[model samples]
Target: MTYLCLGLSICVSIPTYISFMYIRTLRLNTRFIIVRNIVLSVCLRDLMFLFTDFVTSLASKPSYLCEVTGALLQYMSTCAFLWMLCASTDIWLKVHFPYFNHANNIYFYRSLSYISPMFIVCATIGGFRSGYVDENSCWLSITSQSMWVFYSTAIVLIVLISIELAMVACKTTQALKNSVQPANIASTKDPKQSRNMAKSFLPLLAVFGITWILGIFLVIGGTIIFDLLFVIVNGLQGFVLFLSQFLFSKQVHNAWTESKERATTRTL
Candidate 1:
């Protein structure tokens, strides 16, 4: 079952990673920059999972390899969630302060997403040392006291993202009800634009948020059912994100269409 889950995850993640790379090169939006980083982080995390959880066990490697792989997996996974938080915060900031220089702040977001995880992993390793890796697998042992450091940080991030999304939803609802054009609302005169902005972020929040929420439960002594569900749902996260943000995105579709047409014109 573990092999099945990891296989499915890697299969989906590779294509999703490729699609994101293509879109990132062409889109050139501040939002896509955050999203691209998120996807890349997830892909790397999945790869680390393959090595630490699967390959290391089969190879019967030494404990230090497990420690290193565990640390890398922890770092990359934390980076993925932190990037998700950044995305949520970006939406919240855009909704509340429409004219804010988000592009300029992209550097700050990137730094936070990458560096914060390093600190968490470092603290865990520094404090626990040998406790960072499970003897049986190249991962933080759920039974270990040091594991809380990692899980707690993930929970806090999940909570923060949920709060930001809720606030954005409320603000958008209020704007639509009042029928007033706030700077934070859409730049266009349309009243529904605020609602649209809120709606657009829902799928992303749902996918990452719900998957990790289930993960938290599984870690906290969930049953076999919870374990299975987490494996299947979490494995599909990249594919879901691809469907919502890339494959079905009108912006992506239009961009591709325009690029093809431009190529045809150049050919002519």
Candidate 2:
């Protein structure tokens, strides 16, 4: 999972960074560009979480060190998913509202996304502290209360992502069905007739959705299994999901390459 997540992070972060760069370089509207930038930032968060997870995964006796690295991992993993929830909410707004225009700046939206999590973090700080460091390994294991917190957070994320995926799927299916012609060669012909925004969205959406869904299950299973094995499988599952997103798509690769070039030029 560690490798998978890191690989996915590299895969996603690079292209997301590039795509935003390309959008900025183009004559795009400020608002649309801002939205894309927000999404790119979320991908960056995912990468950070992946790195943190990879580190924790490598350390010996990870569970014993839940106070330091484990806390960091929890923060990253939780926040990354929350950021994705931001993406879903943003996209859902775009789809549902379509014209509820507001002049709120990018900072406003970004701040909005972080504010809720910050509150939760603050609440958690006082209420649910990791009491005894297991001292076994570098993995994470909060108290049963924290366990519940983590579980709840994971469930919320699963639900939110699932909602986004379902929305995307329904929209895509409808669009494709609408586009199909009557029973003729044209319908199943060599050349395609049309494509909808929903269709264009499916590949990325599927990557995002499927990976997380599969990942959450793995983590749950790991937590239930014997201690040492739990960390291994859970971490592995998270990485798998992360990697799956990037591996299953090509555009993500292109975007990543572009971002690297831009970063290189800046460094030079």
Candidate 3:
């Protein structure tokens, strides 16, 4: 069940992320770049997870394979969450302080997405050499100390996502209140665009929240129910991300529609 869902998620998300890559407008936008990177990271992480699981099942004692896969798993999964943090932070700043220039710091945001996770994963691996395939799974087995690092990261992300969601809610309410004004009526951009923009993060938050919460619970105790929950939620992570990008995002949606039309015309 776990592999099945993760496989399906990868199948859907990779093409969706690739579609964004080809869309000039989405490719150029700083916020969308963050989102695309997030999708890319999640897809990579899920693919790695599936591959490692398959390899582990086939070779009982694949020497040093566990360490490599575990390190990569840690790095990629951490990157996914951190990139999501960057996206939320970027979006919140854009919404709250509309004039602030994010374009100048796109490099900075991109650096965080890659660098921080590499540093943490390297430190963890070097300090303890901490990755081995257990009887049932191939991952960084959670010791008391290592578990802290993992869960702590998730906790911080959850807090940041929560704060971003609250800010978005407040902004959406204010936008709605002002949307009734005559001056707002005269604005060039659709007022609904702002509301839609604010609501976009809701699905993101829901996906991150549900997946990580299941992870945290699994750490606390594992039963059949929690195992099932973890598999389904974690497996859905990539697909949820793809849906958030392709379905909810207006720019991506428009670009995708245009791409399909172009393809259809060429086929004729």
Candidate 4:
């Protein structure tokens, strides 16, 4: 678990840092700004979880330590999901109504997306302070009271993502239908773009799905396999987030290609 956490932190942090420091195009784009927040949220969540686990392991009585770490974990994780929801909704709007004017309101929309999750997290923590360092683990425990908070949020996120995926599919199907007929030479293939967005989004949905599904299953049946899967899925969330950026992000690929070209020119 320690090694997995360390690996996830390194993998997620390096690209996240590079994207902020070096990717000028990504910084300028509103969509990428939402993505950047998601990246930062995932990185912080992973690193904080690692730190809390490490500290809790050493402390004799991790009473206060548990509360602090557990709260942070909840906040950061929930923030990531909310940011993802924002990103998907933005894309859905753009795809379904490409001509809609958003230039003036984009910043306000982005701010709302970023700010709303904090309130949800605060409410959860205040309403139910059930998360604590478990006897065996140094992470948030899914106690009966806290289960609803964590599981309900997770379920909501998954449902939202699933809806976004369906929207993207519809956009893609329409784009493909248009592409098949005699159309203008320069007409944009919206489906291709939607496909890319969906590709990047699916893994994030999968991460949430796997973790929560396994968790729900364990709660219901308490099987060994479900228990093992829950631990594995929970532990590897950071790594999955890191992978999704590379696997699904067209901007990340473009940035990499441009960087490679620059490197080659410098060498020449």
- Clashes within 3 Å, all models in order: 0, 17, 0, 0
RMSD of 2: 8.3
**TM-score for candidate 1:** 0.89
Give the total clashing residue pairs for model 2. Answer: 17
| lDDT for 259 (candidate 1) | 72
**Could you estimate the TM-score for every candidate?**
0.89, 0.55, 0.85, 0.79
Q: Residue 80, candidate 1: how far off, in angstroms?
A: 0.7
**lDDT (tens digit, per residue) of candidate 4 on 1-268:** 5457546655876676566557676676666677677777777777776777677677476477666776777777777777778777777766666666645546765566556656765776676665533544545565635646767887888798789878777767766787652132112354576567767777777886887788778756678777777767776766676667654556787976887788899999
| lDDT-better candidate, 2 vs 3 | 3
- What digit string (tens of lDDT, one per residue) describes model 3 on residues 1-268? 9879998889988888787788777788776788888888888999898878876787466557776777788889888888878877776666656656668767988788799888887777666653333434667666524655766887788798778857756765676687552342223155455556556767877877787787777877778898898888888888887777687666777877887898899999
lDDT value for model 4: 0.68
lDDT (Cα) of model 2: 0.48
lDDT score of residue 221 within candidate 3: 79
Query: Candidate 1's residue-wise lDDT over 1-268, tens digit each?
Result: 6557656656766676565566534447777677778777877787787777664557467778788888898899889888888888887887777776777878898889898888888889888875777778677877667777777788788789889878877887777788776766664466465456556667766766677778778777799888888777766666666666677767667767877787899999
Shift of residue 1 alpha carbon in model 4, Å: 3.8
Model 1 segments more than 4 A misplaced: 1-9, 23-26, 186-194
Best by TM-score, which number?
A: 1
What C-alpha lDDT does candidate 1 achieve relative to the native structure? Answer: 0.74
Instruction: Write one digit per residue (lDDT tens) for candidate 2, span 1-268.
Output: 4455445545655554454456433214333344354344445445555555555556464443445554544555565556555545544554444455533434565665555556655555456455422234333343334545655776677577568756755644554567643332232232121123224334444554455455455546644434444334433432343343334434446655766899999999
